[model samples]
Target: MTKSAAPSTEYPGLFSPHQEPLPGALDGELLYSWCARFHRLSGNSKASTTSQMLFGHATTGLRHDFPGQLGYFGAATGGHLGTLQEIVQARTQFALHALFLDESTRRATESVFQGNDRSQLSRTLGLSRSGQVSLTPLKACPACIGEDRGTVLTGWWRMDHQWPSMYACLKHRCLLNVMANQGRAHWLQEWYLPVELREDQWAEHTEMGQSQVERLIHIARWTEALLHQRDIYFDATLLRHVYLYQAKARGWMTWDGALRFATLRAAFADSHRGLEALPGWEFIKEVGSVNGGFLGLLLRKHPGRRHPLKHVLLMAFLYEEPLDFYAQYENSKLILETEGPAALDRRLTDMQSRLIEMVESEGKSANASCLELGIPTTQGLRLLTRKNVAVHRRPRILTDALKAELEALLRAGTERDEIARRLKLRKAYVKDYLATQPELRNAWEQAAKVQLAARYRAHFLRVLEDNPDVPIKRIRRIGGNGFEWLYRNDREWLAENLPGIWRRPET
Candidate 1:
């Protein structure tokens, strides 16, 4: 039988949010691209609407400006985009943090996904405040796009092609395209379909000769492998040791066990000969310089993270296979990373920085931040306060009855301090509230007179109702506060409403 047509309402996205299948995801499609697709489908005129709908607040810079805001994305959407299966795929299958970040950096960034409360989600790779990097260009594979069009699909950006130091596409064995006019952050401001192959543009970004082109392609494929091939995280220190040990064995390091900067730089230059046609090639060359220009940056004593491209390109030159690189790292005889008081000190310092960021930058509750960091409240709170990070607890809402009770206490001439203490509220807040409430002000002004009348009115009524024999003067005496004040303020009220026996004045 022929398949029946689905209902008109059976359409996806007819009722709620929808996401286009993440583009080029199997080969590392970026989360940022998926965010743009989601925004487009949302039909939101303002990009903030999409961000605010996903994240609790409307933060623009971190949303589209970077390739991944994994923690923030996971928190806001909770892995729900199209469906449960899609959520799993996008978060697990296509995630770059799991592959790119060093162990500590990955732990810090992925805290949000794991439901841990680290404030480092907004941070870019443990960079200091002064170390803000410029936004890199959004890159695309022109050949991939041209191929996609053959299947009637639009070209889209791929993560593997866009990474720093990746000069070509591993899949198509071709150099990637750069949209110079359209930078990374606002690329999603307008719809951007995948590009078709442009020979002129390709020539601009790539080298001409087959030999020069073939060499860069190897580096690109190696970078892609770095993103996907690793099943377990390797210690960056061990990796560094392995690289140095291999470099020494290959005679690429000095007799003093230092990186042979000139030789390595020469090799890098020789491999990608004439690639200066691509923008920023000079800077990469300078970083790879043998004069210790960026050598200390790549291999550090304490293990500072390097750009993924720097690690991959160096690995590409040093070893034929990624496994060979891993094998070298595994057999290294370097001191253990987790050892001694120095290690303890480093761990403590890292925790402090993470806590301060969580409370100060991420606006997490200080207590929750502490709990997530697995530290004690006393120590965490003390450290945060010492660093001048405000440990703000969530404000409790004032119930209507609390306001009424406060009004009552105020009317009864209770001290503001006593009222605050009794209600467990701030004195300033209570005072400010009373100043704003006209009803409370009115009650306060008439409280003395109201209390006087209330005292006399009850006694006066009981005498008339239950004891006709009781004297009116005695009833007035039993009422508290001054009888003269009541008489002067409420004489008419008393005279008109009292029983016949209590109606007349004693005089």
Candidate 2:
């Protein structure tokens, strides 16, 4: 049978403010190995060295020296080595001391050095005479290390102070300065040091009494690690204020006090994984005073401790904090949850109604109307009215009176040529119109042939009726077939009946 571990004991108050201890430091070899591992994980070239891995450089002549020591090179002041790593290590060491030691020991150790000349002791370590000394252990930072080692460095430095301080170094100084200036360092000294320190038996600089320095270093390292972790998840510049506020609040407040209540509430957001399960403002009220402001109002009215105001307020602040990402995420979620199928259905229904209306307005026979509506006639028919709509317009035909006139002339034995001359219309027009009519279609079709034969007989009779001055042969020669045909059919008859007179040529 497998054995299960016992549940851990809980603190009496879930909402009580607690000082969480920093994680333990890895061994020196492990740290070096981790640096190498970090380089490998980052996909850097295998030719890189540990210093290059840590400092972002690959120089062959880089130097290493003890913390807070300075070196000189050809009239130039240089010292310090592994500035970033050392500062980070110092912070970790301070945080660890704070975690393991009691407040009195921490305080007593902090009080040992009154002035800020941390580098005064560097002379004993064989550093350059022209180089300045930094009194504060935190000032024994990475740049200080690099300066002592005669190597170039990168990152933050105070221009007026003439010392390059890494971000980690500055943070440590800031935290301590906030405590010291605010008169709260004693609070930490009182709460975190061991009980034996209460008797004043502890000697300064002894390993037993190094807890305070250890705490400072541990806090620095832990803070650095926390910063690194946060950088992985968020933009560092944006969250810098948050970390600063937390540090200030923690240092200034009485043990487990209301200092960070608002900040804590703001940090707990639903979007932050696993935070929904944690008691936020209720936890704050349990440990802090009820008269503190909006949080206090919540605690007073909602004593049930289940009101969602805390969570709501937290989410609101977080959404406000990172305006870009939060707003985009919120908008995307709303569009996804509310718009998909319903919006599509509404659009489709509108299209169908428009199609129906268009077809009904333009009838099926009107192809131009279908073109105007951007739909093919076949598809448009589907949308038209179900009833078979009829069109009344048809092709025009010749009238009955016109057809009868042509038929009477055709039956009269009067020559077709004479009839055409009397009508004064084109022969083809009369023939075509007569042929198109069903009643006279056949008669008109054969009329042209019969008309030519009648013209020949008429021409011979007309020539006998009217004798001309010219011989028949010359007249036939001058007129040829066309004039002879006209003369025989109608011209000769007109000349014989009428008085002799010259006529103009037909145009």
Give each model a TM-score: 0.50, 0.15
lDDT accuracy of residue 376 in candidate 2: 40
Per-residue alpha-carbon lDDT of candidate 2 for residues 81-113, written as tens digits (9 for 90 to 100)? 222334323322222222222455434333322
How good is model 2 by TM-score? 0.15
User: Which segments of candidate 2 are over 4 A away from where they belong?
Assistant: 1-81, 84-230, 233-287, 291-507
The C-alpha RMSD of each candidate to the native structure, in angstroms, is 33.1, 45.3
How many Å off is the CA of 347 in candidate 2? 28
- lDDT by residue (396-424, candidate 1, tens digit) is 67789887898888888666656766775
Quality of model 2 by C-alpha lDDT: 0.31
lDDT of candidate 1 at residue 111, scale 0 to 100: 39
